[model samples]
Target: MISDHILLTLQVLPILPTLAATNLRQRISAFIHERTYQAPPDGHVKNVIVIGGSFGGYQAVKRLTKTLPTGYRVVLVEKNSHLNYVFAFPRFIVVKGHEQNAFIPYSGISKGALEGIFHHIQDTAMEVTERFVELKSGARLEYEYLVIATGSSSKLPSKVSSTESKYAQQELRGMQDKIRQAGRIAIVGGGAVGVQLVSDIKDFYPEKEVTLIHSRAQLLHSFGPRLRDLITETLTGMGVTLRLNARPDLSSETNTLKFWNGDEEMYDLIIPCTGQQPNSNIISTVSPASISKETSHILVKPTLQVMDDRYPYIFAFGDVAATGGPRMGRAAMFQADIVVDNIQQLIAGSRNLCVYKPKFWFEGAIKLTLGKNRVALYIQQENGQEILVDSNLGHEDGDVKSQWAFFGADAEELETRKI
Candidate 1:
């Protein structure tokens, strides 16, 4: 036993040197934060209110809390008990265990609120105004500065099940059960969600028949050809039937689909990933002028202030803002930073306001995970050329790992931790 123990220790020692540096770094970083940190209490009176605590809302509120002083009583209102990692919703619907990683609790948001700097309210905003907002619970909150970052929503499983955490999980379970039992699955739209849904199903159940129908000839139509072509190849290789340039006229009564090419098909499971609508209902009361009649997105000035110039204190961003840009996480954060900076300027009694200029396509950038161990990074060069770069991200088991670490909407310890 002694001889074996010595051999094992020697074998582990060689590997320990490699991991020791990384582990030591994480330990040192954690030690410092634990020594000095206090999380703001949950839910409080409103001086500055932020609605919709997702990517844009969370970033905006966190930045405000870190920057604003004692006089500012910041409040964050979110309908969901936990922040939902929407990008992982597709995989969660098609698999098990992944749902656990999608919803992150709000309790870990700030280390603990000194100086009335942070508060959270798990409530829905029924209506909004320049002065106050009415909650669904019939409670009204007054605010000096208001930020609407409610983002958008799609069908269940594609997003979250509901605002309630338990109910949402139950809904996800039901969807997962349906997916397991269904013989043939039909996913409409070649957007990211739809593509991910079909791929996830096919990846797990190669025997199951899966079809992806997109109105456009290409997948991820917003991106350039190379990326779309790569996705098409990946799906085709995965045994997915792609119906491009064929907008199927769906009949709920008959439960059948008729394509433009006169082909008809039926499926045991039908998932419509299209029609992601903004949760801009609050703006209807506060600033109807900010609502775009065509797109239904809230219109904001270059400074990200609401369409009403006079009501500079009220603002909107994230997916709700009509910035004519892609609704990616990075883009939302960009808008959030500008909004927070501009808010700081005004709060400091400074006349100069920062304007939000949309970045070029290359600067925005997004990665698409086609399947396990298959990903393509879409980027634009300075010369206005777009390219889909190859990736070595061997993500197995679930597609939500890296995203959870980066923007999973949970991880209180990691939220304030830097490494």
Candidate 2:
């Protein structure tokens, strides 16, 4: 009997060559356009406005500005002035002195050839219409095409709730101080965030009593059993207690928690690590039919455009789009590439557009930190085997330097917070 993993590998293996060629062609085309494309008169420009300047929206802006032809400019409407390094949030809240590194400045986003083709507005989108978007400051932006990449929202530790980097740093420092002072810490929700955070706390302060409370018997149930078992064993070995299959009564006092089975425990700190909602209010406000009734995510076609035929010019991706895959940064980037190509095709008067197919297994891979200096990269082999590649090499500052370089910024800029 062939396992599901093996079958998935077999299915994807046959198409690897095609996928590689397609990706190569995209790169070649983008390179050619980047060097030779010329912009038309400043007065005769059409806008391709993209909302939310995180993973998907940022990538879309980068690609569109490089590949789109003359007379088209990309207007990036982002609420935050900087890109929130969300992947580093779990570690930032636990570690000390590196919280500011989690926010990367956006000033350098339009350097080099991207200068004239890009314009960024640091404001929130209050409402969306078929033709334009209304901002919180009462300004309206008319767009020939729109990309909704508003992503999702979650509480601190799992995500940075503040738009301001200063406030976000303070919040993370506060959490770090709380973790430092508290002898007994209770972390609710044993998902990825909870697991990673609790492990960091325990790994950092071995003497502290860290308890992970989860509603399910397994950690990361979306992944395979081997990874789950490995995490369970690793956490248990680090002296972290696991309380499974129960939820805490939220009505209890700030320092006291009561479980469903009448179990009660007193703690100095209790952190809730669950609850994430899609930031699809702007789209839902005007086009209610475009939102999924069950998930509240925006309904998007395989081509990454809004499902509503009336608004073919509007597209949504990332967490806000119901892409039938794991909500991941990698998936968002992949979706953005396809959206960029489709938008370019539409701009060039071509009906042939690329569709976004979720690369489930590849995008689902996670490099989870077990401790400050230990990490595990989880991968699924071609023969249905889920393997965990454990490593001792890990970064205390969440390896933010690599991300700084990825954004084409100097490490010195990150140090000065000037980018």
Candidate 3:
């Protein structure tokens, strides 16, 4: 059997060289291009503004910068100064000293000669009109085409609630200290965040009594039965009290949880991993018909363009779009590809455009960490058979440095890196 450390290395080894070569190439190109590259006259340039800098928006901006024709540029307006490593949040909030690494610099997003083709605006987009986005800073950006990948929002640690890296670091540290002091902790929600958080807390502080309460019968309701069963076994074995089909009454006071079944649990701390609301308010007023009445997610057609035909140039994806699939980073990246392609086609005055098919089974791939150095990877085969690989191959910091380098971000100087 391959050792756990070796298995972990095997997963990360293939990408290291590629990242290294790409980083070196970008650095050299940036040095030369920054000096030689000249911008077009303002009147000649057409802007394709991409809102949000998370996975979907990031992927869209990266592709747009490379594929856009001359006279067109990608303007990314993202509130966060850094590209947050959201997957590492569950671990970073539990493990100390690695919180600062969760935020990666966005400077490398426009690597090499593409630097001149891209612009990053670190500001909140308050509203979107037919041809302009109003920023909270009172600046207006006019765009020929708009890609809204606003993603989702939740409480801290589930999603970092800060726009700056320094504040985000403090958010994680505060959560970690809270978890450290709590003797009886209750995690509400059985989603990926809840499962990962409960397990990590238990693994790191075995002495603390941790309970994961899910309103549904299954932990991950969207996943297949095999993986769900395995997760149940793993969490049970870790001594994490699983309260399935358990709903915590919201009226309960602080440090105490009450259930409709007349059950009560005392906790020093209660963390809610539930309620991930889409950040779709920017376009809600401008294009009310584009928003889903049910999910409040921006409605997108199969082509990834806004459902309302009046705004065909507008595209939405990620957790904020009703893609009829699980809200995941992988799916967002896939959708971004389609959004970029279609926008490129439209820019070239072509009626032909790409459509985004929701490949959930494939894009739904997830890696869940059970405990310190313990992990589970879930994927579906071609025939729709689910496969779960349970292994002790996770890192305490969730390999934050590798992710930073993946974005071509410098680990030594993340705090001061400009957006």
Candidate 4:
């Protein structure tokens, strides 16, 4: 009972490990090295603190460590114990036996970036001041420059538990149990997460009744119309009940949902696959004018620096910045390139500053796994058309290897062995 008039904008969007050292002296030397190294007493070294260890923050810290001049220490502050590789969350959360691989150890990143140049702190940021970030642990990390990349949060299972690593694992396992127990599942918000969850759940338990309710007429409203049609077809073909242009009543009970269309449904479980909301409170407090009330993003220039001229040195990106593009992981990585380059130019006393140009379209490339075997990819074509390709990666494809094999992936692990 959805109308075609609500066809509007939707942006589709888009995920480490450790290793052993070669020698004993090198191992000892590296073991003693600090991940979040401090400057010398004489203040010869500059502190480059990057908050958030997700895709963008990790990339920023990695770039700083490899490119920054010597004596400039890179510090990454992440509250989580491990970098949860969420790319496979849609699949891994549904299918069993993949939970162990979902989380990559935060230890042993930046194979050759430099000894003692990069440091990691397992803590959360409570506020941002002009000179430094105040941590929840009552520690102040002073920085010559700061990068905010605290990405948004979503429902658990789709997102790992927000607590510590062990608890996160337990939470994921708990969701697995719930998925197994629930005969009827309702997923709210038909973005990438909701659609993908429908496919994943159907693949895992084909007999279960799974329903996806989207508020927009088009599932991925920002994506090209072609992709939206394809998603609708695939979801229905795979046995998911699709409800378009429907909003759930907030006052409904825990297990029941009443829709805006005057329809009500009862399910054993309901999961909200929400989109990213900027974690901009800390920086917004410091420079209120730098944030936009509309999008909850810290207003930044194209160079990714805060709009407030008084604090141009502070930069924001990823889900936290109003960057005028789809907030994709790759987009954040691209922003890191510009931020790091500009920081380099600033420290080198060079007038040339690199402006950031997003590589992906405003919505980024559309990637969704319809089922264990069916994968769909959407690339933008010229004149506003979209090239849609569907492939079957299959449940047992060899190409899907653990991504931690390469260095500088996942922005270097939080912990690394010395040497």
Pick by lDDT: which candidate is best?
2
List, residue by residue over 1-419, the lDDT tens digit for candidate 2. 77544555665688799879977997898788777767667678889999999988888988887787777889999998689888888898888878888888775568655546888999999889878999998999999999999988888787766778888788899888999999999999888888899999999999999999988888887788878998999999999999999889866657999887888899999999976899998987678999999889999899988889998899999999997756888889989988888898898889998988776667777789888988887766445567566778998987898987787655787777633
> Candidate 1, which ten residues in sequence have the lowest lDDT sum?
410-419
> What TM-score should be assigned to candidate 2?
0.92
lDDT per residue for candidate 1 within 342-397, as digits (tens), equals: 88788879869888876656236776666666666676544556555566574653
Write down the lDDT that model 1 would get: 0.75
Per-residue lDDT for 1-419 in model 3, tens only? 66544544555577579658965764574466456545666677889999999888888887776667767888999999889889999998998877877888887686653545888899999999999999999999999999999998898667887899899989999998999999999999999999999989998899999999999999998888977898898889989999999998866567789998988888899999998888888898889988888889998898888899999899998899988766888899888888887987898799899888776655787899988998888876446666667888778778776877777777667544422
Candidate 4's displacement at residue 177, Å, is 0.9
Choose 1 or 2, whichever is better by lDDT.
Answer: 2
Please give the CA lDDT of all the candidate structures.
0.75, 0.85, 0.84, 0.74
Global local distance difference test of model 2: 0.85
TM-score of candidate 4 on Cα atoms, chains taken together: 0.85
Off by over 4 Å in 1: 1-46, 112-115, 250-254, 260-262, 397-419
lDDT of 3: 0.84
- For each candidate in turn, the TM-score is 0.83, 0.92, 0.89, 0.85
lDDT for 251 (candidate 1)? 54
Better of 2 and 4 by lDDT: 2
Query: Considering lDDT, which of the candidate structures 3 and 4 is the better prediction for this target?
Result: 3
Residue-level lDDT for 105 in candidate 1: 65
Candidates 3 and 4, the one with greater TM-score: 3
